[model samples]
Target: MIFEKFGKKRESAPPHQATPTDDSVSISRRNFLKKTGLFISGAVVGEHESEKFLKKIFKVPSAEVSPKEAVKIMPHKEKHVSAHSPEALSEPSPEVSTETSKESSPLDAYSFLDGQIHPVAIPTGELAGNTFSDLYAMYLGMPNGTVVPETLHVDFKENLATLWRKKFNLPARSHDERVEREQLQFLEEHHNLMNLAEYVYRSYDAKSPNTMTLEEYRNDVVGAVEKSRKVFVDTLPLVPTSASEDGVFSKDKISLISKMGESLTADTLMSLSFTELMPLDKGSANAQVFGFLLRNAGVDFIDRIPSVYDMLESFGPYQITPDALSPKSAGSWATQVLSALPLGFMPWNVDELLRGKENIAAYTLAMLNIAQFIGTRNSAQLKCLSEVMHTLPSTQRAKAVLSFVAAAHHRPHEAYDAFDAFIWSMYVERAHSFREEDILRHIPTKDLREYTGKALANYRFLASGASVNNST
Candidate 1:
């Protein structure tokens, strides 16, 4: 049964095609290894290529161009040195004893003379060596060089890519960045409710005093319940099974609901413990708190426990007369009885037991008997209370019903009122109307409180008719 709860299957797969046992195992093992190996190797190759590609595009090596290449590629004009001169002198430096023929005709007419030619500015010799150096200083404190640092080091690949992207003036849409963005969106949408619920619980439960006051804690619980209720209500708009389209809750709503219930239960238990620690008479303030809580919450049992106590004493001595009972045994018996109870009455019983320090088993048995009898009389209350139980948070809802079995036996008068009130509340709140017939269906005329005067006046009309019918 427990395994079924976890969705585990005990059945093994049908036998594979019959083969030599060792061969079959070996084949399966080989297939698994082959797939794993391919996956890992592909990942490694992809990473290696990615790194190399990033490095190449960033042009880190481009900055270190060879000096020879720099000079070859230097933007400058070739020398037309000495070209503007007498034709003969420029022609060949005319080793003709000077200018013998002086190109006699033209020379004599032009008096040929040596001249120098300079067309704009150009480097003649080894300026190439200093070309890049000078350019580096000019741009990088040198002409045509960049004012970039000599080196940069990145420890993580993400950092490396970020820097490269910035250097290249690339837009923010790289594969890695896009993938990260998508992942963030997916996680945000997937875990919003879960994360919120967790935060609320932790925020309320934190050990640090700075987080919340008692009022704040109470408010937080209320807020969480309200939110959960709203989500559940919103789910109605969705196709019964289509939570996705409805946007009613994330897939984690179940987990959130569970966590919320757990937090609320723990906090409530803590509050109860605090009540226990109060000095006897000092409990009034705690009672007031409980009262306030009951008023705010829609449950009816919270209003009727004291009434139950009063009624139980109405019949006979209902005091806790401790008899032959070990505390452990009593506790064990109570636990068993409480465990078996239906969910609607469990919380009331738990509250009763924890409210006093009497022999729990004896008191619990007495309480259960009273509740059963009263439940028979006030069937309307029983039905109303049952409806309330159905609406409570899961863990508490069932346990609350179980608590009643113990209450019914201990304090019949009070239990009757408390139980009936609970049932009435449940019916009104859940069903929107309470039919008298429904009440009579569960409560037998033999037990109707109407015969006892104002105590059960709520059903006097039925009680009178029932009495007349019996006489006839």
Candidate 2:
């Protein structure tokens, strides 16, 4: 019964082909057979074993195999039959098989299995997902008609005060307090010159309006003269002479010089009839007398002179007694006094009153004046004007200079020329003496020009009724 069953199974199996020698078989084929579970114990069946099995089962001879055949077939062996039933291999359900087929088709399996496969998933719709552009726009987009806020401008003087505090080693106080303290110190030190100090203090005071019309300034001068006449008594002789060859003047002579000096304290020097101090002919006896008096007055007396001169200069416009004092003589005198004074006299100048101080009103007026000069292209005015700018801290200096440049560009020749030849000449003197490079060093020329252009455009836009926030 065993032989009959084996014979029947051998008849049902396919015919075996001749096998190639082990050496002639390729590594790929050997690997394929091993992977497919066709080999027993991971090794190829021996030709002898195959032949023996075939002969025993179907009575076939090994010599009958053709040399051209390469495939070798083995007869199936009956599995061990146990007394108990065997468990069947588990199979997927129909639905599970269908899902697995869809998930891993021949193409997918080939892609996964093949080394040279290039696969790409095809996009199915226009709006596949949020793209980078869409996401970027969503994050960055602003609503239509959104309004930007106007840029607030800081006062240049405040900027100057802040910068001054930062750059210089000063007392630990607010800028305003420091300024006031200095002004008070200046006043206290020169108590005799209270009137001139008061005038300067008022000019730089934040509470006072910084500007004055020519008429107003002249009227103040006249009032100052009357006030001085009331408060100061001129007791000394008009002319005093040296009593000795050493050039030491008598006490009465010194007293007279001191009284004449009082003219400065009273703010009456500007009001003095030019006849009283003029025609300063280099060779004249009167000029010689005046020169001697000034020389003998001592350094302390000369030190007080610059502040008085600065007060007179601050008036901006005034008339001189042409017969008594030529513009040339006035200029010469101013030059002489300026040269005689030390550099400390600089703070006494009207423009420098608020140095290391907080005086926005005065700073604004200065800006206005600088802007006017820029439009005029009056290098002389700009020259003198730049002095105040030079005194500012670096940041404030740049800002003030740029503001001047911008204002000039914005309103070129907008106003008629108000300064006369003498005034222009005087400014030319001061301007030529000023070191422009000192201030220009703070800002690049190109940046200044660009800033001017932008400022002009802004001014034009504002003039046209466009909002500054939207102008750019």
Q: Assess every candidate by TM-score.
A: 0.18, 0.16
Best by TM-score: 1
Q: Pairing residues by index, what is the TM-score of model 2?
A: 0.16
RMSD of every prediction: 38.2, 48.3
Candidate 1, residues 6-108, lDDT tens digits: the string is 0111124221111001123122322322321211122232223223322222222323432112111111122222212212122211111212221221111
Q: How accurate is candidate 1 locally (lDDT)?
A: 0.26
Off by over 4 Å in 1: 1-319, 322-363, 370-383, 394-411, 431-472
lDDT of each: 0.26, 0.24
TM-score of 1: 0.18
